[model samples]
Target: MKKYALNLIFVFMTTAAILLNAYSCFAKDIAFQSSVDKNRVSLGDDIILSLTFTGTQSIPAPDFTNVEGFHAKYIGPSTMVSIINGSMSASITHKYVLIPLKAGKFQVGPVTFKYGSDTYASNILTVEVVEGPVSDNRPIRTAGVPPLKFEDKIFVVMEPQRTQAYLNETIPLKIKLYVNKLPVRDIQLPQFAHDGFSTEALDRPRQYEEIRQGILYDVLEFDTVIFGTRPGISNLGPAELDCVLLEKQRRTGGIFGDDDPFDDFFGKYTAYPLHLKSNQVSMTILPLPEEGKPQNFSGAVGSFDFNLEADPKYVKAGDPVTVKMIVRGDGNLNTVTTPNIGSQDNFKVYDPQFKQEGNTKTFEQVVIPKIETVTEIPAVSFNFFDPAKKQYVTITKGPIPIKVEKSTEREGLKIVEADAISRPLVKKETLGRDIIYIKELPGNLRKKDAYLYKNKLFLLLQSILLLCFIIIVTLNKRRERLKTDIRYARRIRAPKEARNGLKESKKYLSQGKIQNFYDTIFGTLQKYLGDKFHLPSAGITANIIDEVLKNKNIDERVLDELRSIFNECDVARYAPTEVSVEKMQNTFLKLERIIDYLERQKL
Candidate 1:
């Protein structure tokens, strides 16, 4: 009896211990977060505000009554439910998204929330409102120019041939580096953004003798072509140049065991500082037209000529005819519409295979001969408008002739079914069968309901569609919220974008295409700038970037690092001296480090 009692007690204790362990492992039921635009806010200027929370239990919303010198605007609230690591968890964020109506030296009182009978309050936050510039309390230095480098005054200008173009239109964007008072050494083309367009270099940079704005300038030009994707507006920014400026500076240095304190602070020292800066250029984007467009219109842009032909115009009815179409011109040949082959009663048509060649400026294609058989092949025509001539041109083919021939004789085999009248059912006789035998009645035949609701598969499909519709609606709403909250969206994707350029550069190097390798690098960096500052690359210049960075509260050290990396790439690529493979490889590796460091840092 005592042993049985002891066993029962042990089992009960084990159960209790297991329950306690499970309860202890449970995640905290509440989370807290707070954010504001400026620690030292300015009066009359709006400061953004936000709040975040996570919990499993239902919690009452907090009150925002009688908050001093602060007004709150309730943009909205959203909840995100997710299963993380085999555990059900949820987060409900209540955003104030406030724009302060008035500001002063004030304290925002602790926010109180009720969870069951317990109350929780956030810590009070103090803010100072000032009228003058929000002092960042950082030293300001002149944009430094690196010594022994031609980059201090050197810069790049990207002039796109056309900002507005059709889907397959050839865009010849020219990048010109205009040498100012500084001597001409070399210039290189930066990388580009690849989304929504296909790109190819027009030609190697060419040197030209030219004068601009009453001054003789040594100019080098590079060109490229871009094919827009769809009928929608987009922006292409200018290719940025990072030039190293060689500037001389005097500074004080320290020595080991120096007795003089003044020598330690301002010991005379001469050193050259490398000044770096990233410059951006912007271009306008225009969407292609879709309305009144032809069904078979290929994505061809620019001017072109069309020709149709068929080998062996005369053939037997059973023999196939090969109809070929050749489109050649300066415009987009790859995207040309399929030629219309006139329909005939006795003829059957098949789709033609297509092939294309050439870069952006000049594209060429040939549609393989479409095979078909006919009693008589009729005339075919193709029509298109000529922009340069300002008139319509229509090309036509002849009404080809075909001959019919009787079939060759076969010895023994015979076709079973020819025509309904040609075949009659063969009758068979069964002997010794007196009484007619009836098969047992088949199972009951029931008519199925045709109504949509009665179809199980249809109902399931409808439910899936409905769920998709709900998801789309939710996504649209979230997009609107993100648009309104620009800062949040930028924080998520900016780092990845910056790192993408350097990573792509490595790939190009592995492929052993030096020019393309550099191009990818520049393109990636330009994309980062656009995403970083919310400005199109076309409109950004070194001066513009410097100004924006100043406004962004970025430190001089970070800016210097950015400038140095860009300068190294530009000078190395375009310098009059040839860039060795070893030097290029080294620079490529350095660029990776620069990008990684920039991404890990906060601006």
Candidate 2:
């Protein structure tokens, strides 16, 4: 037993020595270098610049005071510790998102840092800013130079190809978002209010850069088609869009070191939500003209080409021949109808099959020659109103000749179901089997009720329909209440928000971030109370919360707990010092319990 114990001790000491030797390589070289995610980026595009310290995670971030051609925003620091092949190494990387302001090739820092008696300098990083948008295949609409508005940072515009269009004529609509040097994300689809018109859904937007008044702006355009439905003056906008904007702002005081030189560079990103609305567009919708209107004219208001083709033109009598009618061009093909083969003496026509792809619509039908004398197919006319010509046009095609040979097949006999002579049919049975009277049933047969309400399947289907209607009504009412009832919506959102805030506070606490923890805690309590009482979060104060809850006969102990937390958060955030982990845990628990108690109250 003693020998085994000695062997175990010897193994443990050997392992410890190996681990220490491996980890001692962490600070051996103390090398610093800089790199970027992209060597080439488009103007107004974002690139990441990283300063990697290949020595230790304890090094302070170096200043990027000489970053050219791009505005630098310090996001955060990342640390990595790895043991590879019995060698332990650690590194700290500081990352910055660089938004290019101009088009040029620029060099980023040879950043220098001093530690102990040694100094380290990072290598320079070169980045090229291309003059246009990122590589995308979709072509952007750059014809209209939209005037900048609202500080020229961000705006949206809605423009139509023409202000006036004939009824049933299609107009190309463009909705564009111009972002000039502003960092934006989460762009929503624009809502275009097009009354007195029919519209197609907006397709995927094309992104590119356009120059306006000697300034470059990033453009995202949505192209869609719309047509006037009725003749009159119509208004078509107040186009609305929502997006989130990112702006660099000073940190609202965190627990991190205040004397750090990189604080300004490491400023926080604040999101400002924006709703952009474009002006309403008023335009005249001209009615279609009445002169020289074709008798069979349909509302097809664009240029089009028509063709007719027949296959198996030499079929025998009673054999089928397929004829295809194709109409292709820049028009609403939905309004183009199949041409009728008009009255033929010895031909039978069947319903045609229709297919549409891109700008073409094709109709195919099978016509059988009933007799061998059918010399040709009849002619049919297609009529449409051309908005460009402002007149009606009619195109006629057919009289397609074909060879129809008579079939040599034998004829079959036809069956006559009833005798042509109407002798008393009820009393004329000569066979052994007795026949029932024509006008009446046998006495043994029972009659069935023809009322539809007696059906079980019908009743079941109606019950299911009624249940579905009730469910839909309930959901619709709930949606409307959420939209219009502010207090109710807030009350519903209170618990989820409280949970999220507490979760964030707990994360900060674990990270040893004292000021952030207090700030999150304080904000959480404020938002919770504000939502619970249906007040603004910005106006919520400890005293106000106390008054509000006290009026509702809240427990004094709960109020005292709330007051203590609020005061602690105030003190810790403004005059932040060391706060114990145990204290933070206790504060978190108290906050959670108080929130639970308040939520349980009817008020």
> Which candidate wins on lDDT?
2
- The digit string of per-residue lDDT tens for model 1 on 1-603 reads 456446655655565566456545643646665544344655555554444465532332344534677666544344433332234444444445334446467776577766445767766666666675556541211113123234423556677766666555667777666654342211234555546677775576554434443333435566777766655666565465332222223343434344532232233433232222233333344444444445554445556666655656555444556766666677655456666666645555566666665532221222222333344456665555443443445657655555444334446976565776687877676775756778798778886646657656556555655565566557655654443343344445556755666777877777777777765766566556645654443333345447567666655665665676566656645763465677668767665665565566675
How does candidate 2 score on lDDT?
0.74
Best by TM-score: 2
RMSD of each: 28.0, 22.1
lDDT of each: 0.53, 0.74
The global Cα lDDT (0 to 1) of model 1 is: 0.53
lDDT of 2 by residue, 430-466 (tens): 8857865576645677666545476555455556555
Segments in model 2 whose C-alpha atoms lie over 4 Å from true places: 1-151, 252-267, 411-603
Clashing pairs in 2: none
Off by over 4 Å in 1: 1-153, 180-189, 194-196, 241-292, 295-299, 344-351, 357-603
The all-Cα superposition gives candidate 1 an RMSD in Å to the true structure of: 28.0
**All candidates' TM-scores?**
0.33, 0.45
